[model samples]
Each structure stands twice: as C-alpha cells, then as structure tokens.
Target: LSPADHLVVVRPNYATNIETPKAIGCAISYVDLDFDQGFAIDIEHVKAELRPNTKLISVTCPHNPTGTMMTRADLDALIALAEHHKCRLLVDETYRDLSYGERLPAAASLSPSAISVCSLSKAFGIPGIRIGWLLTRDPQLQETFLAAKEQIGICGSVIDEAIARATLERRDAFLASLLPEMARRRDIVQAWIDGETLVDWVRPQGGVVGFPRLNIDAGFDLDRFYTRLLEEHGAYVGPGHWFEMPKRFFRLGFGWPTEAELRGGLAAISAALRS
Candidate 1:
C-alpha cells in the first residue's frame, strides 16, 4: 500500500498489476506462472514470495492472456493465506463471467480481507465507458477507496453509470446469448491448436484468450510470421511481450472476432507459419 510495504503479484499479468505497484514504489515479488505447468499458480509458490511487510497479494481469475482458471479450493487457500498474514488479497475478476464451467465466488464475499475487482470492459466489450469497481467487505477500506477516487476526479460520467446499470440488469440474458457463442469459438481455436504443428498451448479453461507458444524447435521464422500475419493476412495477435513474456508466446483472442474472422485468423497463422 506504501513505499515501505511489500506486494506480491502474479505474473505475467495485466499491465495494471505490475505498473501500479511499481508506481507506488512498493517492494515487490512476483509469483510467476509457468507455461510448462499449464500456467498454474500454487499457494506454496505464493507463500515463498511473502515478506513480513507484504500488504497485498494480487491474482487474476480466468487470467488474461493465458486464460487459466484457479480452482475454488485454491482461491480459498489464497484468502486464508491473506488472513493468516494479516494482508489483503486482490482478486481481479474481470473475466469471471466468461467461465467455461462453474465460476468461483466473488473473493470479497468470501472474506473481509479479500478484494474483488471487475469491469464491463472485458466480458461486455464496453471499455469506452471506462467503468470498473473494486469490492471489499471492510467499510473503512471502502471509505479509503472513495477518498482516493475523490482525489483523482470529481465523479464518474452519469451516462456511463446508467449504461453500466442497464447492462448489469440484463447481464444474465446477455451472457446466456454470449457464452455459447464463446464456447463455439473456443472450440475452433482448440481444434486449430490441436492440428497446428508450429504451436502448442495449455488449453484455456475460461475467458476469450489463449497463450500459445510457437515451437521454436521447428525453426519457424517468427519475424516473418508476424510480418506476414499483419501485412499479408491482415490479422494480429497480442505478442507475448505485451504481457512481459517471451517472443515465442502470443495471446490469441476469440471473443471479439466473428466466426468467419476467427477461422480466417487461424488460417492466417498457418499461412504465416508456412511462409
């Protein structure tokens, strides 16, 4: 929370997770998720990074880029760890609503020490509204957050709030239509990965994205691949560097593109590879 405090972060994370703590000048440790391990985060790995001054531990569910989902038991363990250490656990649940199976309970609902963060930017595709919120059971903490918000700006746009409210009111109906389509797209992606010799991936459990690493052993020309993917095929992916990862890895998003576009993108990847 301060310059003298220690913060534990899960990586390779969204930029906000890394940048915010660095900006605060907090002594930081990273619990780096391993691609070989299916990007799994273990409680023991988290415990290893803990310092006595550790004030917050940050993690993501249905993680960005990798799209790995943590089990409910793992989440409970994280909350217990935070409680035992007398620290706070920040769970970024931005992609929680897009789960392929059962979704974990909101972290804040599980414990006063745990916080949940979410936005309409991801699942609902409404980033122009710039709406997001943090959840905490501690009233004092909530007040502290409001005070911080006051310092940043006068108030959020009324139009954005109204739109967000309307969206939330119809969330279930929206998701009911959206999720099945997401699953279909997800399957198409999975099938492409299964057949593609130039890449390998840990199948995403949820969310719109998957991190797939190019098989460098195949001697694929990555520089050409990117150039062709963009110039010739008119398709793009989030290069691994976007998430502070190796160049061999890339984030493929399935949620936004139309079915035809998704297939074209997959084909483009293959075409790029073959080139």
Candidate 2:
C-alpha cells in the first residue's frame, strides 16, 4: 500500500503488524481487544474504525500474546466488511496449524479481497528458515504483490525453500506428535492458574502463549515481582510492554520448554508473587 493509505489494525498485536505499517507511513486506527471481554474482536468496533481511504484491516487467528481464536461467523463478518469497503483484509495465520479446536478457513480462500499470511516459524518452530507466504485470489493484486516482493529480495533462499517444502510434506505427522504434548502443557498451565489468586488469565484456546495479568491493588510492588522472577529464579516472560499494554500483563509460552522447566517456571511465578 502507498504512504497515503489508511490501515485499521488490532491493538496489542504482533509488533510487526503495527511496526511495518508505521514504517510505510500508513495512517492507522487501532481496534483494541479488551481484557474484560476475553480479548475477543468486536466486528462492529472494527467496522466503526474504517475510514474512506482504509486499504487494509489486519488481524490474526489464534492471536499473538492472548492466544484467542475467532469464531467462523466473526471471520465471515470481517471478510464481508472488507468486501463492502473495498479494502483488503490481512489475516495472519502463523499459528493456524496449532489450533486447539476447529480451524477457521484461510481468509483468502473465501474472498478475493482478503489476504492470508502463514509461516513455519510458530507452529513448526523453524524461524531460522525464515520462510513465509502471502495469498490472494485477486489476479491484479497478486501481480502487484509479486512486483513488490521481487523488488525487495528477488526470490527466496533455495535451501530454506527446500527445508520448508520437506517440513510441509510431513506437516501432519509433526503436528500429531506435538499436539498431545501441547495439550498436556496447556492443562498444566490451566491448573496452575486455577490454583493462583495472585494472577488470572482469559484461558488461551489455541497457540503456545497466554497473556495473564497480576491481580494486584495499588500497594503491590510490581517491580519487585519482576525482579524476583528474573534474578531470583532465572525465569523470563514476554512483558506486556512488548505489546504496548500495562506491565501487569505478560505473555507466557508453554510449548517450547520441557515439562520440568515449565513447572519450575510456573513455580517461580508463585514464589516471586509471594516475595
């Protein structure tokens, strides 16, 4: 999109979603998903934010940090809005293969005006390969996107392409081996949250991450909790500041760490809270 274009995006989104648009000098409107509402996207809120020049509406499924998934009806409404407004709808599906329930259809498949982007980075744990793709059914738009991609890098790396291909070839087997373990880890986190009054979460439906907030009043020493979590226990989390939220919220990942390490980290959170 051109510098003069307007973009509507979700707040507390993946950093690149906001950052890249800002870099392009696109005017942006943010539709914030609220904690009180379980971080679900309000379609009317999104529709209200659209401007005459809005070129794109950006969102994610199994969203980053919060790990909330959109219902199929909501997804359809978003696509319909984009179609009505003559703007592209960009759906980031990096974690699509990791769904804890029914997976929504790739948005691009349902609309010529929608774009779907996916990568092996999240679900396959292969960011080093640095491979991802964008999809659109519109021929003219596809050509424009291809021209822009060619200007940027000419083509993808041969080795990375080969590796990505091989990985996709066995994607089902990989997911089968991983999903059961992820479910167990997810259960462990749920049980911990159930037992703790110091913090609470919206309960992630999918993906490896969940954003939980500390249940503290004004007198709580929030800094001390973070300090003890790190220096005292060597545990780290994606701070809310990383997503432009208040420091009470943090992104906790349950997919990468071993079961022992995950339990240890959860325990550290408890100890740090008490300290």
Q: What number of clashing residue pairs does each candidate have, in the order they appear?
A: 0, 0
Ten-residue region with minimum lDDT total, candidate 2 = 219-228
Q: lDDT of each structure?
A: 0.91, 0.92
Supply the global lDDT for candidate 2: 0.92
lDDT of 2 by residue, 1-275 (tens): 77999999987788888998899999999998899999999999999999999999999998998989999999999999999999999999999999988988999999998999999999999999999999999999889889989999988899999999999999999999888888789899999999999889988888899999989888887777888899999899887889999888999999999999999999999998887
Candidate 1 residue lDDT tens string, 1-275 = 78999989998887988898899899889888898888999789899889899999999998988989999889999999999999999999999999989988999999999999999999999999999999999999999999999999879999999999999999999999999989889899989988999888888888899999988655666777788899999999988888888878999999998889999999999888877
**Residue runs of model 2 more than 4 Å from their true location after superposition:** none
Clashes by residue pair, model 1: none
Poorest 10 consecutive residues of model 1 by lDDT?
216-225
- Let me know the TM-score candidate 2 reaches against the reference structure: 0.97
